[model samples]
Target chain A: MVKVVRNVVCPFCGTLCDDLEILVEDNHIVGTRHACRIGNAKFMHFEGAVRYTEPLMRENKKDDFKKVDYETAIEETARLLTEAALPLIYGWSATECHAHMYGVELAELVGAVIDNTASV
Target chain B: MQDVGYPVCTLGEVKNRADVVIYWGSNPMHAHPRHMSRYSVFARGFFRERGREDRTLIVVDPRETDSAKLADIHLQVEPHKDYELISAMRAVLKGFELQTDKVAGVPADLIYEAVEICKNAQFGQLYFAMGVTMTRGKHRNIDNAISLVIDLNAYTKFGLMPMRGHYNVNGFNQVLTWVTGYPFGVDFSRGYPRYNPGETTANDLLQRGETDMMLNIASDPGAHFPQKAVQHMAKIPLVCIDPHETPTTQLANIIIPPAIAGVEVEGTAYRMDGVPIQLRKVIDPPEGVLPDREILKMLIKKVKEML
Candidate 1:
């Protein structure tokens, strides 16, 4: 079964073509219409089977990455940020403003600088 | 983001009144497939009488692109010679011939023909992208392209805009400018806005080995940046915040999977031409996985408490 959702904007490029018709079935984006090749690829792979659904950790004592609890991972990250003298928090081109503001606030709290994909 | 003033118009205006559409150094067919079908060729606008039949399409590039194949006129100039061709076109429009019979590998006749097309159009729109901005003499190439449009105003109503990349790239530039007083590369390490592209740009700093730790959000520098920059990223303690798996994820010490903006999360984004639009969610993300802002907000609180 297919249900076409209309006027879906493509978030890939700056064109932001909003007349897209997505074919959804069982919460999976089965197909799309009125979009470019890039948009199709992005939509087609929206739900990745290999996504990291849990917090991961590569602690100094451990030789390999270990799946850890979310709170533990956050605490580890906070510990690292607190220790680093001049951290570089970067990459914000694909996110929203509220998130970018949070990133900035995090960077500022640590007296660290922030950049974006524009820099790289 | 510069203070340079130029003629500006919305995409709606292009659809409504533009009789001649010029794609310079861009292949919208591959880059922006629906641009022609929606805005220039097939849009049922107020004055466009018969869709594509009422308009003329022109393409200018060093090599023929997929989009150029559909052009009524294609000016295939030499690579790294766009500045010369643009200057020559400007000179021709002002009723002057090039000192050489051929300039930028294009014959005098072809130059004149392109000049004629630009001059005769009732409402012409020039859309250019990285071709003019990324090559040698980048700024000069843009200056000449803008100058050509400015010159064309004498004969016809013309507007030109950069084919900006990314749905919200302009949004970052706009928002950063409004809040921080500078566009892309703004530094606040000193607790104030410090603006300098070369000095503060990501790759430059990475190449120079300036940063100790790197937190990458929503962008994959490992995939797009040079191997040297990526190598630098690998050496540092890297953190990634994105929805999908990319090469950057491989080097990341911490990979935070945030809810996909415009997909699992709703927010506002700025289009290439500075038009703001709201993004609607199509589905829910994984349970407990929050939006980018929420995740960052979590880190902000933790980082602040630690600080």
Candidate 2:
């Protein structure tokens, strides 16, 4: 069955043109309208990239990202972050406000240097 | 104040109604590709049926950029002399004589011509960028731009807007102002909001080696920062949260893949002009992956447990 969604906002840019219309078929966005070039590119982001379906971990300075279980990988990641004396948390440009709020808390606990893409 | 500053309008209003559009240091073609098409010259509007014809385009920059090529008046000002140029314009607007043969790269005659254009416009808007903010004088340049707009308002309706890069940089500033009672690049390590752009800025901290660990979210300092700052980032324990692989991610100790904002997640982001817009989710994220909000929540929970 086909579905028509209305009043979709393109969050790629700050313009946030809220006139995007998406046509979905079989759980896929088959058609889009009123979106800019970047917006359309964002919609088709996964079409041409090799997706990382499994969790990856690297213990040494090698390009060896062993496929680890999700919990194991996350735990290790958390351990590395918590152990660091000064950790810089950047790249919040694409994240949501909810994530940014949580990020503030995490940075405070670790006393880490939290910065977004804007610093660059 | 809606955090940083309020009473801002979208670029849409500027294109449709503004008779004068000033591009001060912003190369919109490289940064905002759609800005010129949708909000500046090409877009057909009510009063501006002949888009480019109805509006006056002024490109004030240090170089003859691609945007400058499309401008009616291109003021190729000297790099980092934005304060002097703006001060000169203000002085001319206030009926004062320029003491020097030149201010920036433009002559006194050109400065007066620019001021006359600004003062005579029915509605004028200044859209500036990092070129003004990252130069030698920094915030002082911004002060001049703002004060010039104030002076222009004496004759006509005039406004100014910073061409914020990220979609949510103004959002960050807004949130910071609410939480810490300050604007962008604010530091709370001193138990209060302390904002000093160069001193507390990311580049200076990384250069001086004051920061030990760095957590970089959705940003890539390695690509844009100076060599010294990039070197510091490479040596630090960096945590990168982004969808794409970047130079910063290559050196990161923990690389967290986040659900793309506005696509797989929903949130609020402030526009360049301080307008808050809602980002709606269109689809689910990767099977095992979480949105940035969810990832942060998980990290926060783990950190609290450790504490």
Clash totals for all candidate models: 1, 19
Q: How close is candidate 2 to the true structure, as a TM-score?
A: 0.88
* Candidate 1 TM-score, true structure as reference: 0.90
TM-scores of all models? 0.90, 0.88
Identify the candidate with maximal DockQ.
1
Model 1 deviation from native, Cα RMSD in Å: 2.7
Would you give me the overall lDDT of model 1?
Answer: 0.78
lDDT of 2 by residue, A1-120 (tens): 767777887766655567788776765677788776677766765565544445555655346656665566556657766787655555566556767777766766766555554544
Query: Which candidate leads the pack in TM-score?
Result: 1
lDDT of each: 0.78, 0.73
Error of 1 at B143 (Å): 3.7
Q: Give the DockQ-based CAPRI class for model 2.
A: acceptable
**In angstroms, how far off is B210's CA in candidate 1?**
2.3
For residues B1-307, write the lDDT of model 1, one tens digit per residue: 2534467788888898998998888888888777888887567678996878888888888887888888888888888899888989999999997788789988888889888988999899999888777777765677778888989999999998777666777777777777777766667678887777777778778878888787888787888887888888888787777677788877878777788887778887777677888876776787888788877777777877876
Q: Tens-digit lDDT track for model 2 on B92-157?
A: 999999987788989788888888889999888888888887787876777778878877878998
lDDT of 2: 0.73
